[model samples]
Target: MSTRHVLLGLLASGPSHGYDLKRRHDEQFPEARPLAYGQVYTTLQRLVRDGLAEVDGTGSDGGPERTAYRATEEGTRELSRWAGEITPPAPFVTNEIFAKVVVSILSGGDPAAYLRAQRAAHMGRMRELTAVKSAAGAGLATVLSADYALNHLDADLRWMTTTEDRLTTLTAEVDAA
Candidate 1:
C-alpha cells in the first residue's frame, strides 16, 4: 500500500492528527492491515517536508498536544494525479507460496503435500471471509473488503489446483534446470 498517498488522501478530507488519521485509515480500508501510530506520524512529517501537507494546527484539551495536518495545494494535485492513475494488475508473481513450491521441488521435498496444506489454509481463510461478508449489518466497506479478499483467494486456489496437476512436469523441469 502507498502509505504516503493514503495519508495524503486522508489529509485531503480535512485536517487530522496522527491518531485520527490511523483510526480513519483502519475504518476506511478494513481489509488492509491497521496502520501503526509511529508510521502515521513519520509519514505526516515526510509529507510536510515534501510540501504535500502542512501542519494545520496544534491543540490540547487537558491532554497532550495534538498536531493536526492538512494537505497542501501541491498535495491535492498529487492526490488527484495518483487517484487518476490505474494501478498495475500484479505484473509479476513473486508470492511466497510459488517460491516455496519451487524450492521444495528442487530440494526433493514433497511439493504435493505442501500444496495440499497451502490449499487447505486458503480454503479456511475463504470460509472466514465468507462469513464476514455474510454477517448481518456488515457495513458496505467491510463487505467490499471481504469480497476483494475472497476474489484473490479464489484466484490463488485455482492456480494451486493447476500447479498440483502439473507437479510431475514441474518437478522434472526443475530437476533439469
Candidate 2:
C-alpha cells in the first residue's frame, strides 16, 4: 500500500504530527516488523503536497515547529476510499510465521521442542493479530485478500496443534517400545 494512504488513514483519526503518524502506524501493524521512519515522514510530506493534509500550526513548539496535519475533505474522501479498499497484505510480504517455522525446523533442534516453541510463538501472535483483526473487522469485510493471510495463520495453528497431538501419541507408543 502507498504510504500516502497509510498516512491518510492515520490522519483521518485526527490531526497529528509526523511522529504521531509513526506511532499510529506501528500500532496498526506488528512491531516484529516495522515500517521505517523514513517511509512515514516521506509519506506525510506527500500527503501534504497532495492536498490530503493541511498544516494545523495552531499547536507547535518553537523548535522545528511541529506541523500538525489535519485531513481535508478531499483527504477524507480519499482516506475513506482507501479504507474501503483495505485488503490483506500479500502472503510473501506478510506471513513470516510460516517462514519462521520452516527456519526453526531447518535449524535442527529437537523437532518436538521446535514444534512446541513454534506453537507457543504462533499462539501468542495469533492473539495479537486477532485483536487487530477484530478492531479492523469492518475494514476486512471487503478485504478478500485477507483470506490468504487468515489461511496461512489457520494452517500454522492447525499444524502446531496436530503435531502436538501426534507427538503425544508417539510418545505413548515409544513408552510401549
Candidate 3:
C-alpha cells in the first residue's frame, strides 16, 4: 500500500495533526495493519517536502502544540487520479506452495505430507476470518476485506488438493529432470 498516497487522502478530508491522522487511518481501514505514529509523521514530512501537503497551522488544545497538515491542490489531483486507476490483476503465478512441492519431490521428501499440513493451516486461518466477517456489528469494510482474503485462501486450498491428486505424475516429471 502507498503510505504517502493514503496520508494525502486523509489530509484531503481536512487539516489534521499526526495523531488525528493515525487514529482516522486505523478507524477507516480496520483490515489494514495499524500505522505507527512514527510512520504517519514520516510520511507526512515527505508529503510536505513533495508539495503534496502543507502545514496548515499549529495550535495547543490544553497541552503541547501540534502542527496540522492539509493536502495541497496538487495532492487533491493526485489522490483523485490514484483513486480512479485500476489495479492490474496478477499476470504471473508466484505459487510458493508449488515451488515447495517441487522442491520436496527433488529432495526425496514427502510432498503429500507437506501439502496436508499446509492445507490444515489454511483452513484454520479461513475459520478465523469467517468468524470475523460473521460477527455482529462488523462494518462493511471489515466484511469485504475478510471476504477478499477468504476467496484467495479458497483458491489456494483448491490448488493444493489438485496438486496432491497429481503427485505421482509430478514426482515422475521432477525425477526425470
Candidate achieving the largest lDDT: 3
Q: Give the TM-score of candidate 1.
A: 0.61
> Relative to the true structure, how large is the alpha-carbon lDDT of every model?
0.93, 0.71, 0.94
Pairs with backbone N, CA or C atoms under 3 Å apart (clashes), candidate 2: none
| TM-score for each of the candidates | 0.61, 0.46, 0.68
Candidate 1 residue-wise lDDT, 1-177, digit = tens: 799999999888789999999999999998798999999989999999999999999999788999999999999999999999999998998999999999999899999999999999999999999999899999998999899999999999999999999999998898888
Candidate 3 Cα lDDT to native? 0.94
How much lDDT does candidate 1 score? 0.93
lDDT of 3 at 121: 100
In TM-score terms, candidate 2 sits at: 0.46
Candidate with the larger TM-score of 2 and 3:
3
lDDT string, candidate 2, 1-177, tens digits: 577877787787788888778877888876346778788777777877988888876554666657688889999999888778847665454456545544544554355776777778866776666665666444754344345566667788896677666765655554565
Measured with C-alpha atoms, the lDDT of residue 154 in candidate 2 is 74
Tell me, by TM-score, which candidate is best. Answer: 3
- Which residue runs of candidate 1 sit more than 4 Å off their true CA positions? 17-23, 30-37, 57-68, 91-96, 109-154
lDDT of 2: 0.71
Candidate 1 Cα RMSD after full superposition onto the native fold (Å): 4.7
